[model samples]
Structures are given as C-alpha cells and as structure tokens.
Target chain A: MSLGIAIISLLLLAGKQIEEKFTRNVAGIDMVIGAKGSPLQLILSSIYQIDAPTGNISLAEANRLTRSPLVKSVIPLSMGDSYQGYRIVGTNQQYLDHFQAEFSEGKTFEKVMEIVLGAKVAQNLGLKIGDTFASQHGFDGEGHAHDEVKFKVVGILKNTNSVLDQIMTTPLESVWAVHEAGHHEEEEGKGANALKLLEEDDHHHDEAEHHEEEQEITSMLIKFRNPAMGMMMARSINQNSTLQTATPAIEINRLFALMGFGIDALKLIALVIIIVSGLSVFVSLYNSLKERKYEMALMLSMGASRTKLFILLLLEGLIISVIGFVIGIFLSRLGLWLMSENIEQNFHYDFNVLSLLIEEIWLFCGALLIGLLAAAIPSLGIYNINISKTLADE
Target chain B: MIATQNLTFAYSPSKQFTFPDFDCADRETMLILGKSGKGKTTFLHLMALLLKPTGGNIQINHQEISQLSVAQAADFRAKNVGIVYQKPHFVHALSVMDNLLLANYLGGKNQAKDKAQSLAESLGFAEHLSKKTTQLSQGEQQRVSIARALMNNPSVILADEPTSSLDDDNCLKVIDLLTKQTQEIGASLVVVTHDQRLKEVFEKQVLL
Candidate 1:
C-alpha cells in the first residue's frame, strides 16, 4: 500500500511540471480571421501556426478593420514560400515586433525581395546573410520552386521557442512576386490582366483602393488595445460584416475546453490504468503474504515486529507505483515530442519541451493519489497474519 | 530466554486455543515436536508473542512482551528474536544483499555492506552475495533466510521446519550450523517441526 502511494506520488510530480507550461503558452491572444473554413483551424493557422489557413481575404478588407472603432492593429500575413521545408511567412514589420523575432545574424528585411529566416530555419537550411535561396511555391513544399524569384537571406532570427523560430519572414510583396513570375496568357483569360498585375507588382504602394477589385490576403492577425473589443468585433463580423472575424484567443479557449474534455477523459483513463497497476501490486503483496504467512510467523517468533511486516508489504506497492509513474511520465513526454514535429511541418507551430501546463500537474497529482489508495489496503493486511498457525504449517 | 503463561488464541469466534505455561532458559536449544493439526506452530507463536493471548503473558529476555506498547513490542521483537521459515521467501526484485539489507534495516539491525558480505561468507553464501534470492535453490534460500534471522544477533531464534527439504546429511549440517550460530551468539533456539529427526538434535524437548 505504501509502495502504491509512493508510485502515484512521483507521477503527479512530473504532471505538475507539464501543466504549468501549457497554461503559460495560452495566456494571450483573442481572435483570428482570414478564410471561411473552421474558426479553430483559422485561429490555429494564423495565430499559433498549427493548422492550414482557411483561404485568403482581400487585403482591402484586412486593412479596413483598423478603421473600425473595435479594431486595433491588424497584422496581415501572406504565406506559401519555404527554403528547404522551413516555412516563409511574408508580413508587415509589425510581425517581427509582435512575436519579438530578434536578429541573431544581420538586420531585418529593409529591401524588397529580402528575406529573414528563423533561427531554426536558418540553422536547419544552412543559409546565412548574402546567401540566395529560391522558395518552394507553396507552404508544404508540394508546389514548384520559384528559382527565378530567388530571395537573399538578409536576416536570421534568434531562437524564441515559438512559431517564429522555424519560419522565414519577408515583405508581403515577396509572396506576390513569387507567384507573379509564373503568370502567363492562359491564366489571364478570366482573371485580371497580367499587365495590370505587372504594374501593381512593380510599384510597392497600397493600390488595392484604386483598383476595381480588392487585393488578396492569406490571413490577418489582429491585436486589440482592449481585449474585450475582440468579442464585440467578432460579434459584429458574424452579424453583417464584410468578412469573417475569428478570435484566436476565443477559439483557442474553446479548443482547450473541448480538448480539456478529451484530455480529461484521457487523463481519467491513464489514472485508472495506474490504479489498476497499483491494485495488481497490492494483490501481489497480499498474495505473497498468504503464501509466506508461516515465514512471517517464524520471523515474528524470531523477533521481527508486526509493524516491520506491514512496512515491508507496503514497500512493495511503493516500488511498483514508482516504476509505473516513471514509465508513464516518460511516455507522456515522448507523446508530446512526437506531436510537436507534425504540428511544426503542417501548421508551423512548435511545441516547446520545457513549458508545462497546469492540467499536467493535476494529472501527476491524481496518479500519486491513486498509487497511495491502491497500496493502503495491502499494508494493513500484514497485521492479521497469525504467526502460530503459519509457523506450524511451515 | 522465553516464557509463556496460560497462553490462549482464537482465529475466529468459533476457533480457540489454550495452552499451559512454558519457558526456555538462556542458551538452550529446544526441539518442539508435534503431530499434524496439534497446534505445534501455534505454541511456538505463543512463545514468540506474535499473537495477542486472550489470557496470560509472554516474556522474552526477561521482558513481559504482552505489556509492551505497539512500538515497544516492535523494537523488542527486532532486537530480541529472529525466525527461520520452512520455505524461504524473499523480496524477489532485490538482490540477495539488498534483501538482507532490507531485513537488517527493518529489523533495526546494522546495515553495513561489508558486515553483510562477511556474514554471508560466514554462512557459506559468499559467492552468491549479490545474486537474487529467487536465483538460489531451496537449500540456498534457506541458508539466506537463516542469515537474515541471525543478522541482528538476537537473544532467541524460532525456526519452523528449517531443514524441511534437506537430505539427511544436509539436514544435520543445517541443524548444526544454526545451533552453533545461536549458541555462539548466546541466543536460545526453538525449532518447530513435525519431523522427529530433529528431536535428538536438541537437549530440551517440548512435545505436542
């Protein structure tokens, strides 16, 4: 019993560490909007960089939100370029400030077509300042490489342990220019003429307002002065707005809550498994006691105390629980690491190893409590062992 | 030395036992021989104070164990007595030395590796000092169990069927070694068994 208690206690210790980290990552952000797909997927792709973007919105609509009374700063993002599997996200200078992407090598992008790579992207791709690398046409590296539109790696971001660590960011014009190089007479049949696109692509100005059609935007990341404004803005967009307004923070909360149910269920299952394992330990010790009653009897006659027998049985449960706790934590950490890689490649989000969440701590505690409960019954069984009958049987 | 006065015990409301007073003086080896179902082990247990006697008292090394508090009884048990079982049992996960160390620690005996190694050698378990008890044979495990019982050098040893699985020669060897160790340590030995072969091995006799 004591052994079971000890095992669960150790797992709880590790779970507590994971929980603290998860809570910190979810501390900020409210909503995100760009495409018309899942609100969760939109928020995940735009804010956390964990999913694919829904679709592109007109740049005019993305920027016009800034004029609204409820809106604050709309951080427009244009993705779909990569250097050796690492993603390249083109955005305004505010992105560098928003995520605090510092330059470890040279300077942030100052010239058009200049690129800034994330620390991991740079390290993984083996590119430095003055190095030129062409981006793959799309974010997933499935599209053709735009070798003609080569971008110079002007800057390298310092490791921030976030989504920014594995991405390459450049001016939003870079994304348009990459696609503009492949424009031909065939694709210009129904869409806007390639000549006008050439003029718009040549000059770097807010030309969408002057054009009959609006500019295309992959997504927009909005930051509000008052966090509550996010709800009002989202409500307005959902009501009769020109475009969809998705809150990254709200979506993330709903996601966590929804996942909390699933996680709570998983945690409950893990806890139950731990208890069953602990119970197996208890049964093992108690069965040993039944078989070794005579041995115990003989020991008692020889001077071993009843309490020592109790402790000995309890110790067995503790050992098993401890073993289980260690294995369970190791497995959970491995599970998190495995999930991180897929998230990085698919959505550009990297789950950090060091940061733990609050729920993980609770999970660890629950494991410990289960261990203790399992071993308690067996430890008490030692008291009932009748030494005389046991010795005679021996 | 050990003594029991008007000792009694009951397994349940239906089963009960009462025995006359008994005692073993210091430095004595008493062979307790009994028939099957005659409560021979029960009498041995009564003397060890393992059971709460519904009536009377048990005294070992001149201290009344029945009057001792729970903790005191535990301390007194660890210090004053040891037992060797018929079938040796051990904490299988631990190595032989670790099992001995656990016994020593829980028994309130010294936990010195050097001392345990030396003791193992003295008992002819020198090469198997680090082996798991489960890896040892029945006889070898018996020796380790005996080693555990003798670790604290208690004033008394209660061995139940100590040589149960042994051949005649090995049985005699075990009896001699255990009695010799007990005598050297000034501990009274009480051997409980159904086999009468051990009756001639002891000077004192308690028959049931």
Candidate 2:
C-alpha cells in the first residue's frame, strides 16, 4: 500500500513541471507573421524555435509592420542561413528586449556586418567578441558560403532559458544584403564577388523597382500596445493590409492543443496504472478477508459489529490510497527532472521541479481520491463476513 | 437480549434449512457445538443479518432484524452486536488505536477514548495501543480486537470459537473480560466453541 502511493505522488510532480514551463514561455506574445506553411509551425519556430519556419518575408513589409498605430514594437527576423550549424537570425535590437536578455559579453549589434551570439551559441561555437565567421546559405552548418562576408561577434546574450539562448542575431540589412549578395554572385559570373560588383548591379536593377523592394526581409514579429488589440489588428491586416498576420498566442495554443493529445495519452497510462494498482489492492484485501474469515467471525463474537469489521476493511483500502497519492507526486517530479534537459532544449519547457501548478494540485488530489474510492469497494468484505458461522467453523 | 423464533436458513443450492425453527435467549452463553458439517456458523450469520433466513424470522430487542433491509441490517448489527472471531482479524496497516477508531466510525458512533484506553489497559493492550496490529503478538492482537468490539458498548456479544487458539491463561482472561463487559452493558453473551473447558463459566449452554 505504501509503495503504490509513493509512486503516484511522484507522477503528480512531473505533470506540474511540464505545465509550468509551457505556461511561462507562452505568456504575453501576441502574433507571428512569416511564410505560408502551418500557422502553428510558424509560432513554434519563430517564438519557440522547435519547428521549421513557414517562409521568409520581405524587409519592406517587415518595416511597414513597425508603422502600425496599434503596434507596441516590431521584431523583424531574417533566417534561412547558418554559421557552422547554428542558425543565423537577422533581426533588430528589439528581439533581445523581447526576451529581456541581459548581456553576458559585449553589446547588441549596431553595424550591419556585426553579429550577436546567444549564450548557447557562443558556448557551443567557442566564439568571442571581435572574432569573425562566415555564414552558410542554409541552416546546415556546412552549406556553401555567400560572398564569405565575415560577420564580427559583437555581443553574447546571457542565457535567458528562452528561445534567445540558441539563436544568433544581426541587423535585418544583413539578411537582405546576404541574400541579395547571393543573387548578385549567381548572375554576375563564376568568380565575381557581391561587394565589388554592387555598384554595377545597382545600375542594371534600376528599372526592376518591385524586385528591389521585395529583396529585404524574411519575417516579422508584431507586438501590440494593448495586447487585446491583436485580434482587431490581425483581422484588419489580413483583409485590408498588403501582408498576412498570425497571432502567436492563439497559434501556440493550437500547437499545445496538439501536444495536449500526448498528455491525454499519458493520463490514460497513469489511469491504467492506478486501475491495475487498485485491482491489486482489491484482490489482496479480498484474499486477506477470506483467509481471516474465522478471525472476523471471532471478532464479531467478541462484541464487534458487522459494520465495524466492514469499516476496518474500508480503512485498510483508504490507507493504500493515501500512500499511493504521495508516491505518485514524487515519481512525477523524478520523471520531470530526469527529462529536464532534453525537454528544455527541444521545447524550451522545463518540467523538472517542485513548483506545483494549480491543475497538478487538483490531479494529485484526484489520484488520492481514486485510491481511496477504489479501496472502499473492496472493504465491503467485512460486512458480508458473519461472526457466528465463522466462529463455529474455526 | 438476543432472541430468535422459527429461524430457518439454507446454504446456496441446498433445498432445506439445517434448523427450520430455532430459538435462543439472553444471558445463556449458548454453545452451539455441532459436528464439522452443521449449520452453526450459518445460524450465527443469519442472526447477524449477514445472511437472510429463508423461512422464519429473528429479532433483537423486538426489532425484526430478519425483516430489515440491507442497510438497516448493517446499522442494526453495528448498534446491537459485538463479535469475536477465532482468527482475530485486524487492519494490517493501521495501529491498534486506529483500528479502534475505525470500529467507532463503522459502528456509527464517536470513539470514547477513555473507554478504549481503560479497556485496553485492563485487557493488557494499552501499551501497544498506538502500535500497528501487524507488530503485535497473537494474544495481544486478540485483546486489541476485544477492545475494538467493546468500543460501541453493544447490547449483544457473540463469540465464535473464542478460545480455540488460546492457552489456559489467555482463555480465562478473554472469557472473563467478555463476560464482565457483557454484563456491564446488559448485553447478551453467546459463545460458540469446541473447547469443553468454557462450559464451567456459563450458567446455561446449548449443544448443537
């Protein structure tokens, strides 16, 4: 009885961790806009960085988002490139502020050629301030370089335990300039460089005015002055404005609902464990009752009521239930801590801690109730056991 | 007082009752000792309302126990009867005190702690009152069981082979306590036993 309850207590703790981490990162962010793929994927990748990006957006459209009267701030992100496998994001200084990142080393980028490294990025890449590295054209660490434009490490952001921990940030001009550098090299000749041929390309592309405007951005993150204005602004932008808008909070909710299915499955498994454990308890108590049949009869003969004997059985079940509840909470915390690093890395969700969520407290209470209730049914054995007959048999 | 009139009971699948019409009265300490195959336990069960009689009826203080519903029978048993079993069961995980508390709860009454403590002290179970039943010796546990039985101050006390497992010393102590407590409550004392020694203590005995 004690062992089963201990296990239940641990599981309750684990459930709390998963819920807390998810709730923390998901708060406050209003909307994400980039590409045409899954809206949820865009939120996850853009806000949480666990999934693929939808597509890139133009810098002009990204700039236009900042001008919205409803906007509190705009965070522009430029991706589709990497420096030795670590993703290279071309965004503004506001991105760091969005995550409330403190400086571990150096400062935010001012010059377009400079890059700010995240704590994990700097630690993993072994880079320091003033060091320069060429970025690949794609997210892969080894993709062919575009112009080999060495970006100086200007800043290293302190670990915030958020998406900012794994990213590399630079000015939005760097992304546009890098991609525009790519097209410039592809068209200008086999061995031609973009920086040298930039003057000649400006003359040839003078008449293609639309291409010039579309060449600057990949995506943008929009925050509102009043967060509640997000729905109205997003609705207006999708219908009346030139670009599409995606709400990160709502989209992430959809993503979590999808993940909620996985949690639901875990609940089913925990339920089975509880049910099986309950049955084991029932069988054990039941078998004990049969073995102690003559004993119960004797107890009854000694002036104990059938009701008293029956309640004793019930009390036994209640004991096992309470024990199981405590155990489950501890097991849950052990599970959270065991999987803490991986869960934090992939999903930015921390589950290995003692801080209990409200929902988990309820779940823990429920487990205790289930254990007690389950035992109550089996405890009915005492009432059915007759005192006189059992005494005679003995 | 415990009384029965024309009491009849049948084991499942059996066509007839072992006793079609049977009766018992108070203060008798009736010993219904039959051979191994008789209906002694069945009669006790029927009387306790653990089983319903097929043909006749039984009553406790003129309340028709045989006619009581399942819930009422349970309540009736809790209020009126105290039983001592041969094997002497206890909740394995609970302390002796908790077992007594459970008795009070199941018997539908508040635990009178002074009564429990005094009874345990008298019965030699007071020192181990807080100890789990699993930790106690067999005689110690039997005494604790007895204390639990007396918790409700029941009107009828029944003993089924109460002395089958005890030595001469425990036999005297157990019977003396049962008899004294029964008299104090004005409750009837009915003991069913195979041992011949107990016959000397009772004023009247019925052999099945």
Candidate 3:
C-alpha cells in the first residue's frame, strides 16, 4: 500500500517537473526546420540534444528563411561530434544569447577550433580555460576521435539548468574545419598540412559565402516575430523543400500525451491498493469488535455513552491513515531523490521534490475518508449491543 | 438506597419475568438467591437500569430510573451504580491500574488515581497494578473488579452471579471484600447468584 502511494506521488512530482522543464526549454523557439524525417525526432535532437539528428540541410538554403518579413532570427546548428558524451553544438552567438547563457571563465570562442564549455561540461571534465581536447565523431562518446584537430576551451558557462549546461558551444566553422581536416588527413596521411588549412579557414569566416552553398548544418532553430506567420511559413517550407518543420509546442504536447497513459495506469493501481488497505482495516476492526462485544457492553453499563465508544473506534482508523500518509510521503521523497540522481547523471536534469504539491493534500484526505468509512461501518455495531444480554451471556 | 416495585420484563412474548419488591438502604447488603433459569440477573439488571422493565418503577437515590432514556440511563448508571459480573472482566489491553481508573473516567468524575492506588492496596492487588489485567489469576481479577466498582463511589453496587464460578473459599473471601468495600463507600451492595453456598452469608435474602 505504501509502495503504491509512493509510486503515485513520485510520478506526479516527476511528471510535473519534466513538463515544466520541457516547456521552459521550448519557450522561445517557434519552430525547428531540419532534414526530412520524424518532426518529433528533429525537435528532440536539435532542441533537446537527446537524440540523433535527422541528417543535415544546406546552410545557404536554411539561411534564406531569414529574408522573410515574419522571421526574426534563425540559428543554424551542426551537431555530429561530442566530447565525452556531451554534444559540442556548432552555432553562432545568437544561440547562446537565446538561452541567456552567462560565462563563468574566459570569453566566447572567436578563432576556429576555440570552444566555450557549459558549466556541467567543464566541471565534470575538469577542464580549465586554456585546456584543449580532441572531438569524437558522434554523441555516444565512443566514436572515432579527431586527434589531429584539438579544440581549445576558451570559456566555461555558468549553470543554466538547461540542455546548454550539458553541451559544448563553438563556431559553425570549427565543425566544418575539424571534419574537413580530419577527412583530408585520413586520405592523404598529411596531418601537419591540416593545421595550415584550419588557420586559413579562420581567416575566411566573414567572406565564407563563396563556399556557404556547399556547407551543411544539422538543423535550424527559427523564431518568428509573429507566431501566426510561423504556421503559414512552416507549411510552405515543408511542402516546397526537402526540410521538415516541427513546432516545439506541438511535439512536446504529443510526448506528454504518450507518457500520460502510463502515469494514469499507475495511479489507478495505487487507488486500488488504497481501497484494499481500507478493506483490510475494516475486516480487522470488525473481527476485533466481535471479540470485544462484551467489553463494549461493560463500558456502557459503567456509564460510557455509545458516541464515546464510537469515537474511540474511529480514532483507530484515523491513526492508521495519518501514519500511512506520513510514511507514504517519506517514501515518495526518497524514491524521487534516487530517480533525480539517476537522471542528473544521464540527462543533466534535476527534480525539485521539496515543494508540497496540492494533489498530495487531496490524496491524504482521500485516504482518511476511506479509513473512516471502513471503520464507521463496523463501529455502528456499538449502538446495537444489548448491555444486559451481553453481560449475562458472557 | 436502591428499591424496585413489581418489576417486570419480557425477552419475547413467551419469555417473561415478574420480580418481588425489594429495597436496600445505603451501607446495606442484600442477596437474591435463585436457580439458573429463574431471572435472578433480570431483577438485578432492572435495578442497575441495564434494561427497562415493561411494568414497574425502580428508584435509586430518590430518582425514578426505570423510565430513563437509553442515554440518560447510561449517564445515571455511571454516576450512581456499579456492577460486578459473575466473570471478572477487564479491558485486556489496559493495566489493572488503568482498568480501575476507567470507571472514574466513564462516570465523568475527576480521575482519582490516589483512590485507585489505595483501593488496589486494600484489595491486595497493589503489586499487580502495572500488569495487564489478563495476567492476573481468577481470584485477583475478581478483587480488581470489586475495586473498580468502588472507584466511582456510586450510591449502589449490583453483583450478578459474582461468585458462581469461584470455589467456596474464594467466594467467601470475595464476598467479604465486596461487602467491606461497599460499607466504606456507603453504597448498597446487591449480589444476585444461583450459587446456594451464599444462602447463609447475607442477613437480607430473597429466594426466587
């Protein structure tokens, strides 16, 4: 019974926390446009960084969306590499400004291969401002290492309590430079020559339109000045181009709807357990009342009113409910803390379990009501005891 | 004092009882002797107000009790009457001391812990005061029941077949303690029993 209650409260608190965090993350971005695939996968990959990206789209084509009167800003993301499971997001300064990320050490990345580490990334990796590391090919932290292209950490961000805290931020040219250099060194076995290409690449950052048509990015995070205009533009983009547009709000709602089914089923099971516990209380009290019928009669003959005995019996139920509620809450908090610890290691997300939810107050009331009703049914026998007959028969 | 006049009761239409008139003044003792099937407990219950008589009136301390309502009868009984059953029963969960205090609590009087201690002392159960009532022997439990009856210092005490199961030796000893305790409280003691051994014990005896 307590396990049921613990699972119920834990689910409620964790579910609300996840929903709030997801909503806060998807707040500013109106739509995500990426290579053609599942819209939800695109949002989860590009925005949440929890999944594989749906291939890449041409940067020049994605950048054309900024010309639209309704478009406010478009941030291109190239995410194929990671440092020890933390994705190194390749984007411009607008992406950092979008999340209000504040640096704790050093400054923003300027030259190619220079990177700014999120707080969690810097702390977990124990990397300082001047430290440098080679990038891996994929986010799994097990892919091929680009040892030839070492990126210098110039800055470390403060804890934003968002996906940014689990990622590395760099200029888009660093991704292009690393992969192009790594590809050249593998083919020609010319490692030192790749360093010359990187230095030349840094000088061409402003006039990169010459090769912008060929450069590709994983996705684009687009914000529209007018929300209604996004709906129309999203439909046109999805129909005319190979890219797919996914609205963050719509995809996240679908995600929760899918998750709610499991939560509701668990709550139903918890409710059944609570009812069964109440029934057991009833059965035990009812059986004890039979054994104590003569005692009840004795007290009555000794001047105890039926109401007093009734309340006495009711108190047994009340005590059971209060104890069950207190233990249930304690167990729920323990369960949530363990779960949040696990999630923190895996997803860098923290759950605040300290706040007392209103739903838990209602759960306590519901438990007490069941307990009282179960006890009241059996305690009614107090009024029916014939004092004279019970005393004589005993 | 406790008195009854032509007290009558019927469990059903076929089972009925008619009792002879009797009265026991304060500081007095009376015995109603009968066989097992004779309604000896019925007459005692009538005086105790545990049951209402179909016809007749019972007066305890100058108040008509047979006409009292269920709630009123319970209240009146707690304040003015105490009863000892054939079998000594205490709330098994409570200690001997708590069982004695229970009477005072139910009677709506201040809990007289000192009186309970003194009663346990005089009744010779003071050593068992902190023990569960179930831990006592039959004789000790009976003595504790008598002490509980006197805790409220009621005006009347009714014992229904209190010694029916006790041996002759224990019976006389319990009777001696019960009478002595009632005399100290100035409450009339009425013992209803089917045991013939008690026939010569009391001066005022009524046979049914």
Candidate 4:
C-alpha cells in the first residue's frame, strides 16, 4: 500500500515537472518548420534537441516563410554537429534573445568560428573562455571531426534552467563554412583543385537556385503574430510547400494525453491499494477488540468511559495512517531524486522534488478519512460491551 | 458505604438472578462467597456500576447509582469505585507505573505520580515501576493491580475472585493487601469469590 502511494505520487510529480519543462523550453515559439516528416519528430528535434533533425530544408524556402503575414519572428537553426555528445547549435543572436539568456563570462558569438558555451556544456567539457575545440559532423562525438577550423569558446552562459543550458551556440555561417570547406576538401581529393571552376559553375545557375544549393538549414523556430491563425498557417504550409510545419503545443498535448491514460490507470490502482489497506486495518482492530473484550470490561468497571475507549481505538488507526502517509511521501521524494539523476544524464532534464504541492495535502486528508472510516466501523463495538458478561466469562 | 436492594440481572429470560440485599460501610471489608455460575461477580458488578441492576436500586454513599447514564456511571465509578479483577489485567504495552497512572488518566484527574510511587513502595514493587507489566510475576502483578485500584483513593473497592489462581501464601498476601489498602483510604472493600478458602478471612459474609 505504501509503495503504491509512493509510486503514484512520484509519477504525478515527475509528470508535472516534465510538462512544465517542455512548455518553458517551447516558450513563445508556436511552430516548427522542417523537412517533411512526423510532426512530433520535428517538435522534439527542433524545440528540445533530444532527437535528430528530420531532414534539412533549403534556407531560401525558410526565408520565404518569414515574410508571411502570420509570422512574428523566425530563428533559423543549423544543427548536425556536436562536441563530446553536447549539441553545437548554429543560430543567430536572436536565438539567445528569444530564450532571454544571460552570459556569465566574455561575450556572445560574432565571428564565424567563435562560440558561446552553455553552463552545463562548459562545465561537463571543462571548456573555459578562449579554449578551442573541433566540432564533429553529427550529434554524437564519434562523427567525423572538422579539425581544420577549431572553434574558440568566446563566452560561457549562466545556468538558464532551460534547453539552452545543454548546448553550445554559434553564428550560422560557421556551420556553412565547415560543411562547405569539407565539400571543397572532398573535391580537392579528386584532383579538382580549380576552385575558380566551381565558382564559375555556381554563377552559371540562377541566384535563388545557387543559394538553395549552397545553404541548407535543419529547421526554423517560428513565433506567430496571432496564435489563432497557427493551424491555418500550418495547413497552408503543409499543402503548398515541401517543408512541413508542426505546432509544438498540439504535439506535446497529444503526447501527454497518451501518457495520461497510463497514469490514470496507475492512480486507480493506488486508490484500490489504499482501500485494501484500510480494510486490513479494520480487520486487525476488530480482531484485537474481540480478544480484549474482558480487558475492556475491566477498564469500564475501573471508570474509563466507553467513549474514551472508542476514541482510543480510533486513534490507533489514525496514527497508523498518518505514519504511512508521511513515510509514503518521503519515499516518493527519494524515488524522484533517484529518477532525476538518470533523466538529467539522458535527457538533460531536472526536477525539484523538494517543492511541495497542494495535491499532496489532499492526499493526506484522503488517507485520514480512510483511517477514520475503517476505525469507526469496528470501534462501534465498544458501545455494546457487556461488562458483567465479559468479566464473568473470563 | 455501598449497598444494594433487590438487585436482579438476566442475560436471557432463562438465566435470571435475584441477588439478596447487602451493605458495607466505610473502612469495612465484606466477602460474597459462591460456587462458579452463582452470580457473585454479577452482584459485585452491579455495586460497581459496571452493570446496571435490571429491577432494583444500588446506592453508594446514599446516592442511587442504578439510574445513572452510561457516561455518568463511568464518571461516578472512576471517582468513587476501584475494582481488582480476578486475572489482574494490566495494559501490557505500558510500564508498571504507567498502568497505575492510567487509572488517574481515565478518572480525568491529575496523575499523582508521588501517590503512585508511595503506593508502589507500600505494595512492595517500587523497583518494578519502570518495567513492562508482562515482566512481573503473577503475585507481583496482583500487587501492582492493587496499587492501581488505590491510585484514585476511591470510596469503594471491589475484588472479583482476585486469588482464584494463587497458592495459600500468595492468596492471603493478596487479600491482606486489599484489606489494608482499603482500610488505609477509609474505603469499603467487597471481595466476591468462588474460592472457599477466603471464607475464614472476613467476619462479614454473604453466601450464594
């Protein structure tokens, strides 16, 4: 019974924490536009950085969406690079402004190869201001390294307690420069050292086509001017363009709705366990009261009131429930603490288990009500005690 | 003083008892002797207000107690009556001193620890005050029971076959303690017993 209560409380607390974290990280960004794929995948990859990007979209196509009347602000993101498993995001200074991030040391990135580290990224990688590191081609550290252009850490951000804390940020041109240089190197390996011929080949195409072929971004985080038009804009984009738009709020609520079914079932099971425990308490008290009939008679003869005896037995049940509730709450916090460590390591998520909730107070009152009902049922026997009969029988 | 007139009780219509009238004044000791099932305990319970007489009145210090409500009877008993049962039932969870203090607690009076200590000292189990009641020998437990009955210094003391399981020496010691404690507090003592050995210990007697 105690274990059931603990597990239910932990699930409720962790669920709320995760939901709050998700909403806070999504912030004012109502939509994500990325390559055609699953809407949930786009939201998870673009907003949370917990998944790989669906695919890359042409920067020109993303720029055209920024000119839409329904759009408020658009921040383009170029991902697919990492340093020791921590993602290095290539975005403009607007991304930092969007998250309201503050720097702890040095300044924000302005140069192509200069970068600013989030607090967790800097601490975990032991990177300080002026330290330099090479970026790998993929989100994991095992990918091919861009060692030719070492990125210098120009600043370190203070702990924001948001998704930004788990990544490094740099100017978008750095990602283009690294990938473009890598492409040039591959061409050079084929003995095509004439870079002028490549420039002439680029000039031969239209400017828009050439830009699209040169620059491809992972996704765009967009805020809507009027949120009520979000679905309308998403529908138009999905039908008219190759790029897909996903509303973060809609996808997250769907995920929670699916998770809610499972949580509700577990909560029902916990309630049943509490009821069964109350029944057990009833049985034990009833049995003991039967065994102690003669003793109760003796007390009555000694001038202890029957009501006092009834309250005494009822208090026994109340004490048990109160103790169980306190222990169960403590166990839930301990379980959350243990789970938070694992989540922080895997998803870069943290929960504050020390924060008390009003729901827990209601839980305690519910437990006490069960205790009272269980005890009151059996303690009614006190009024029927036959002092002469019980003592004479003994 | 405690007295009962035409006291009667019945578990069922087939099992009815009509007890003879009796009275014992302050500082007096009386014995009601009977075989098993003769209702000696029933008559004692009536006088102690634990059982209300079905058809007659019981008077303690000239006040009719049979008409009292359940709460009133319990309050009256706690203030004026003390009972020593046959098996010396102490709350096993409590220490010897706590068992004595329970009487004061139930009676809704201030716990008289000094009085409990003196009673324990006089009853010759002062060292056992801090020990659990279950740790005491049967004879010592009975002595502690006697001390508990005297904790509130009641006006009447009732003992229900308190020495039925004791040997001759322990039986006399228990009866002696009951008589001495009641006499010290000027309370009437009534011992209802099936044990015939106690017939010679008191001058006043009623046989069922």
Q: Is candidate 2 or candidate 3 better by lDDT?
A: 3
Candidate 4 residues B1-208, lDDT tens each? 8998888998789999999889999999989988888988778888887777789988888899999998898899998988888888877778999899999998989999999999999999999999999899999998998899899989999988899989999999899988998999999999999888998899999988
RMSD per candidate (Å) reads 6.3, 8.6, 4.2, 3.5
Where does model 1 sit among the CAPRI classes?
acceptable
lDDT of 1 by residue, A105-195 (tens): 9999977799998887887678889999788865567778787688998889898766677778898878877776655332454455768
Considering summed lDDT, which 10 consecutive residues are worst modelled in model 3 chain B? B42-51
What are the interface RMSDs of all the models? 3.9, 5.4, 0.7, 1.5
**Which residue pairs in candidate 3 collide?**
none
TM-score, B chain alone, candidates in order = 0.92, 0.91, 0.98, 0.98
Q: Which regions of candidate 1 are displaced past 4 Å?
A: A1-45, A48-75, A80-87, A184-216, A219-244, A257-261, A356-361, B1-165, B171-208
DockQ of candidate 2 relative to the true structure: 0.11
Candidate number of the best DockQ? 3
The runs of at least 3 residues in candidate 4 whose Cα sits more than 4 Å from the true structure, single-residue gaps closed, are A144-148, A180-213, A228-233, B18-21, B55-57, B66-69
Q: Which 10 residues in a row give candidate 1 chain B its minimum summed lDDT? A: B44-53
Instruction: State the lDDT of candidate 4 residue by residue for A1-394, as single tens digits.
Output: 4665686688778888889899999989988999999999999989999988999998887788668888889999999999888898999999999989999999999999999999888887899999998899987679999887889999999998889999999998898878767766765665455685576457455656665665889999999899888778888889999999999999999989999999888888888888898899889889999988877887787777788899999999899888888888899999999999888777766787887677888888888998889989999999999877787777
Writing each residue's lDDT as its tens digit, candidate 2 over A159-188 gives: 887667777889877776676667656665
Backbone Cα, N, C clashes tallied per candidate: 41, 54, 0, 0
Give the higher-DockQ candidate: 3 or 4.
3
Chain A TM-scores of all predicted models:
0.80, 0.74, 0.89, 0.89
